[model samples]
Target chain A: MADRGKALALPVTLLLVFEIWARSAHLHSDSLAPPSAVLAALWSAFADGAILTATRDTLMSAFAGLFLGGSIGLALGILLGLLQPVDRLMEVTIEAIRPIPSIALLPIALIALGFGYRMEIAIVSFACIWPVLILARAAVREIEPRLMEVARALKLSPADRVRKIVIPAALPRIFVAFRLAAGIALIVAVTVEIAINPIGLGAAIMAAQQGLQADLMLAYLIWIGLIGFGLNAGLNLMQGRLFGRAALVRDRT
Target chain B: MTRPVIYWRIVSFVVAAAFVGLWQLIANLKLVSPVFLPGPDRAWASLVRGFTAGDLASKLLGTLEHMVYGWFLASVAGIALGALIGSSRTARSYVAPSLEFLRPLPVSAIIPVAIAMFGLTQTMALFVISFGAIWPMLLATIHGFAAVEPRLYEVARSLQMSRLAVIFKIALPSAAPDILAGMRLSLTVALILSVVCEILAGLDGLGHSVLLSARAFRSADLFAGVILLGVIGYLTSLMMSFAEARLLGYRRGVL
Candidate 1:
């Protein structure tokens, strides 16, 4: 724990330096608040429970989108993996669609669904599905062919084959996709809020900035950062618990 | 394609055509609102208008200029600082937590800070882009440097190579693959950040155009702007992959 504190010293020192600079540099304005002021802002927001409320909204939407997108992507990817005909039929469309960033879909969502929670969740899911689909497909493709031969020799039912073989093999890759998609889900959700919906930290930060509440804006950023860190760390811990650290797949493709 | 590949291509084409047909049918027949999902022809016409009748070319050029310069600056600084940290255990130990803390901050979250400091100018966009991009490249570079074989360092030391010589001659070449990988990640992120800043800040760019068209109820124009973004993203990735192949190929003495 002490060593860990040593590793964190640089960041703590940097924040201290920024605080000094903000107060004394003669360049400070409404846009740049000292650390003390930012802490006060954060404390006030926390004390009022505004921070918790916003965090809940952001977390709920992001998780809902991730679950929706991940399941569909996994199912589609397995279908594509098992059937060559289906894979070939969908390859061109999937390839074309996957490269487009999710943020690019914001306008279409805005027009179609309007500025609401539905549009935000739908676009977040859309942005998230591709990574899961692509990686899951690749993972299944990477499965050993001899195992299939053995399953065929055993005359196993297709459902049994999938249950026993495909999912187990694809679990690591699926975890990787989930990790990737988790990040995307947060990003897309926040962006949608910032651009159109105005429901979460994204909106709060933007509102604060526009209102020239620099301390509050900075406070919001710190919360956003903490949420992101917690999500990623939790996912990693889950992955490690399920599969052991050694078996984790780092590269998706 | 040969006969088998040709058959696959035909199947894929049919699937794609069916999707377009469905979209057009729903959009044109008013089963769905045209404001939501414009027909293919309408979107195409909007894209054509964007290119030929509007100033999309200039906005695209502006976005590209900001993205390229910002990403370049980030790459240079990230690699340099990463090399320094990775070369020394003490430096890495002190710096790693700071970097890890900053890494998880969403790129969109920082645009407000950029706006506060620089307003809605090109500089603001560039700052956001570079700031978001730096972490990936830095992390990757550090990994690359740490992965360098200790034997190589010993070999250089025995040969009386200077410290700078050791870094440039031995460390960098060995780390090139990972560094290139980092560059790819950073550049893709920079592209995202660049447009995002435009959208949030109301600066002149594709993202801005998309927002404007959507708000104006010009669904075709909105979809066109969205499609153009896909194209830009696709083309950049294509270019990056090609360059990566070339660089890796040269490293392998195959070019």
Candidate 2:
């Protein structure tokens, strides 16, 4: 732990110096509020419930998209993987469309879905789905043929084979894909919210910036960083627990 | 399996064609507002106009400049730092935790800080792109270098190779694949960040152009920009993949 603290010293020192200077300088007219000012602004925003509401809305859009898009992507990926016909039919089109950044679709989505939570959720979902689907499909296709043959030889029921063999085999890669998708989802959610000026943390940051409330904007920015950090850490922990067990099982086998 | 593959190919093509055809039909039928869903023809015309006018080229060039610089810097720094840390257990243990702490901070989240520090200048855009590109490159380099077979090091030591010689001769080659993979990851991310920064900061690039068109309600122009951005992204990824294949063809042959 002492060594770990020493390891972190550089980054922490840099951040501390930056915060102090920015605060002391009263940089960018108060719009670039110092760390202390940001904290005060954060307290005020919290008291006013604006921060809470915005956070809730952002989280709602993020998780809703994650669930909806993740499910669809997994199903489509499985279909594409298991059925060669589906893969051939859809691969080119998916590839063509997949390269388009999710943000690029925002204007059309805005026009079609209008400016609201639904639009935000749809865009986030669309963005999140592709990576998960692509990874899942690849994982499925890569499953060893011998494993499938063993299941068949054992006279394992189709459902049993799918549930026991297919899912477990795909789980590790799927989780890896999910890690990537999760980052993309958070990014898309924030960007969509910022672009659309929706009632979320993203919007609050924009509003603060526009209002030249540098401190408030900085506070919101810090909150976003914290949220992203927490989510990644949580996911990393979950991945270790789940995939570690799977890895252990494989080792035993 | 062969029959299924053929069937899937046919189905996928049909589905894709049908989807595009439906868009064309819907636009012609006026089923949706042209403002919302411009047809391919309109988008194509706008794309041609943008290209002919030289605006597209300039904007693309602008975006590409920042992306290339940022990516190049990130790759070099990541590899060097990764090598340093990977060479020593103490360095890895000490540096790893801080890297983890910093890595999860979203590139977008830093825009506010960037704008504050650099204002609305190109520096802000470059900073954001570099930040986005750096973490992946760093992590990948570390992973690559750490995973280098110990036997290679033993061989190098047995040969009385100098530290620099060992790094260049053994460590770098062994880590090349991982470093290259990391570069690939960074490329996509750097591109995305470049676009996003341009949009938010309203810089003169494809992202800014798209946002401008969208806000102006120029659906065709917007779509044209979108399509161009997609092409750029696609082409970049293809280029990276091609390079990787060529450079790493030996590994593929080994496999």
Maximum-lDDT candidate: 1
Q: Pick the candidate with the highest TM-score.
A: 1
The parts of candidate 2 lying over 4 Å away from their true place are A15-48, A142-176, A210-216, A247-253, B1-15, B158-160
Instruction: Report the lDDT of model 1 for residue A236.
Output: 78
Steric overlap count per candidate: 0, 4
> Top DockQ: which candidate number?
1
Tens-place lDDT digits, model 1, residues B1-255: 699999898889889889888988888799987767789999998788778998878878867777788899899989999989987778877887778767877877888888888988888888888888888889887877788999999999899998789889988888888888888888778877777877877877888888888889898888887777788778888888898888778666743
Q: Which runs in model 1 stand beyond 4 Å of their true positions?
A: A20-28, A153-157, A250-253, B1-14, B250-255
lDDT of 1 at B248: 77
Extract clashing residue pairs from model 1: none
lDDT at position A179, candidate 1: 88
